[model samples]
Target: MARIKNGILGGVQGCIGDVEGFIRNGEAFIRKRKKKSTVPRSVKQLANMQKMSVIGEMIHSMTSFVALGFELISKNQSFSANNAAKSYQLKHSLQGQYPNLNIDYAQVRLSEGQLPVAVNPIVNLMDNGVQFSWEIDADQSYDRATPRVMLLVYAPALKKSYYTLSGARKNAGTDFMELPDSFKGHELHAYISFITDDKNEISNSAYVGSIGPAFIEGRNEAEDSFKAQNDDHKDVLTTKSIEHKDLLIPAIITIDDIKPEKVVHTKPNDRFDKRAKAVMKRIKK
Candidate 1:
């Protein structure tokens, strides 16, 4: 493929007899038109196509969450964020065989990184919304406490998701995502991950538990992590509840817009809270 230059022809997006011009991710390009293949697809080839179709369909709806999860890996590697996400799902999340293929939600990972993941992660449904919590270590010698949480909840029946990109600090141990009215009486699968306060890194997500009416499945005894902490610790943690009610939004991507678009933050320091900045400063000391 060749890029359309800034000239008389400028850019094109259609076939002009012998040449085919197109725009991908807003970049214009041209290539020679080729005749359609006349050969039949082999069994193996057809199976691969089916796999890509199913996986691509699932990835199409959650590009926003995928962008945050795969941002670091995508930037460091050759693949784009959406492509990197699809590649991982294709290799790991699909279940059954070709004709009977499906996505195993339990195995689905929204984000991947070298950062340490949440220990003993859990999720609970409350009157306000679904709250996600994780065990916080007291050790503060490392760069572990300040990364914000990424709460992801998928409703299998709805084929859509509700999530937040930047949430409470890991040390805060908990965050809430307000659900839409449509989520009433529906089951949801929850996953939690972490992204650096600077947005430079992320952590692999953990499937906390599956939610149902008054019950949780897949978790040994999934309850709000808040219930297990010391009463004194609760006092400190409760004070750290940072409201991101606005960021708790749903995602639905169009089929044509297949590429993952990067979400650019205005300025890192502007988003950092005073408390987190103080904690980081003290930890670095």
Candidate 2:
């Protein structure tokens, strides 16, 4: 009986040793596989790429949400919707291309008649010498290819007065009519109309009242100096306020001035001075 028990014990010990060895070998194999997997540069790059892609998707989602929110807010507020949406789309697209891009306010304020107030007017204004600009979020994410800017001008006096000056097509911000040379001496009333890229649009004509011919109010220094040097120069130095008679009147002819019964006086070239007609033609072409 004692000998049989000893043999059984030996068999059991052997089996336990075998099992321990198998476990050690399995652990080593697993460690080796893990090391091999991580050591390959390509594998590491692929992992990083996946991580970036995921981050980009997250960013895109977040930007899209924000853009939607902006649209809603714009609907309620006086903000430009088209510009806002364009900016949002631009940012998301850029983020997809480069994960770290960000967006912030990059708006350019433009008055009805004057140069755009923010940034360099020359660069911000369109090539046509018009005052037009876009309000953008300064996010590096905004697409460089498709900037958000659109403007329209409505002139009542021109034969064809409604013109769309879309920034997407061409730079037309600087294309405003040169203050008419004939208006150089007078205070002219100009009605300017505009709409932003975002459906946040408005078309009430802005009346720019009385822009005058360029003039200097101060006395002539040259004449004053000459007067100081000569006794007779006093007569020459007598400064008179030179009023430009042309500028004294309203730039646009009033309806009251037109005799209701009389045939409306139309110039042979009735459209010669019509800037709106010119703009409309250019847009159509």
Candidate 3:
């Protein structure tokens, strides 16, 4: 094949008109002609070619593989770039080539790092339930990609956790979650993770730490009542009381009727007074 540069044919074949095809720049002038080679390449040559192939794969997998002359600012940035590069390659590989590639959460988190930032989540005590808000590192003016916020709320007392996701079209930037009455009183711990619009990227997660009901003691009468009840009964009914009708019934009794002189009161007695009173009342009747 001869390359036609400036109307001049270059590269040599075997004969004159035997130049069966010609190529100009990248465009082929004619159909491709196959040439047969009888001599086999040396083992060293084949090994070198295989090594170079892997090198190319590594380069393609590196997110920070600048052409040749450019420099990057930080090593951490370079490392993250490399991860991004590897992720993109994996994504491409799985699209049509390899459909069975295992792209799980760990891989996605390592590669894309696409999650948004959750900053200064405020857990406010409210009257009816719990109100929460967080500063999302998101903007309404840009990006067609919607924001998704996920929360994992746990109550140590309940030994259970609740998982939730933001609604469709909700911007996480100024988003908030209003927990139902089930979250009231008992201390709760929470953490948040974010997803951008494409669902292909995610950000690192942030722990909101442990937060009690928005209605803390002295904050409101309801909270004060909750604390008073919790104090009087060490294993007081938690917010889960909503699930059990019997638990929802507030304790109703009067220790004021007990003649103070008739009973010997101690620290333990003070602590178990309610229980003892209930037991004694049951026994008396």
Candidate 4:
């Protein structure tokens, strides 16, 4: 009986050990599966973060573009009118040298007291090539004797590089620059400086912006038409002046129906005839 009791206790102990081992194995398997599941979740979270970052960048870029467009359009009308007036004045001043000369002018207006000059949404093409136009208020009182205007253009792709020039004029602007054929897709920027005869000046060197590829649809047709008219005027001057010299030269000699020589002569063919003959002879010689 004692042996049988001992055998039963031992069997019970072995069964408990076997159950505990099975429980331990099951726990380990569950832990391994949990870890495996978490790896995919981690990868998914990382992917989501990357996508959000890309979206944020895109939104930022688009917002900048929209803002720039709005600013350009809003100030364009007034700026263009002002520039046209100034150009008219300049042309009027230069009329003696260039009788048939005129300027086809437009302006890119900025917001009241903006840093950079306003950029035209459309690209401007001139005789030289494509360029931009903007209005700049003179910083200091320009001297009538030696007024000075300064213009700066920045090439966006080449970093902060710029082109600068100085001249005499209170409200002078720029024509388009000749761009290389390979520079079709590049960007450009513009700034303004005004210097007075006293050497006092203002420089807004921080003014910076960007340009883009020229769109065929955005060409300034009105400006182009104005240029065409001016060109036609030039062509007329070149071609028609030789045939119409009488229209160009004023009549210096006026002839009256009554001959002055005949009426004023006291002695008919006396000294007057001799003087007239001598003058004629001198003229012929």
The number of the candidate with the highest TM-score is 1
lDDT per residue (tens digit) for residues 102-163 in model 2: 32212211122221222222222222223433233344233222322333222222211222
The TM-scores, one per candidate, come to: 0.64, 0.19, 0.33, 0.26
By lDDT: ranked, best first:
1, 3, 4, 2
| Model 4 residue 68 CA deviation in Å | 28
Whole-model lDDT for model 4 versus the true structure? 0.36
RMSD to native for every prediction? 23.1, 28.4, 18.0, 27.1
TM-score of 2: 0.19
How many clashing pairs does model 2 include? 20
Off by over 4 Å in 4: 1-127, 130-147, 160-162, 173-182, 205-209, 214-285
Which segments of model 1 are wrong by more than 4 Å? 1-42, 213-285
Structure candidate 1, residue pairs in collision: none
**What does the lDDT come to for candidate 3?**
0.45
- Candidate whose lDDT is highest: 1
* lDDT of every model, 2 decimals: 0.73, 0.32, 0.45, 0.36
lDDT of 1 by residue, 210-261 (tens): 8865223333333344334433333443212222211211121222322224
Native RMSD of candidate 2 (Å): 28.4
In angstroms, how far off is 263's CA in candidate 2?
51
Q: For residues 1-285, could you state the per-residue lDDT of candidate 3 as single tens digits? A: 244445554433233343455433333444435676688977666654554443334434222222110112212342334444444434542221122222222222212243445667655545654345675444544452365665555554454455555433335444345565556678776656555555444555455666774344347777779667656754442333222222223443234423334444335446465755654575467
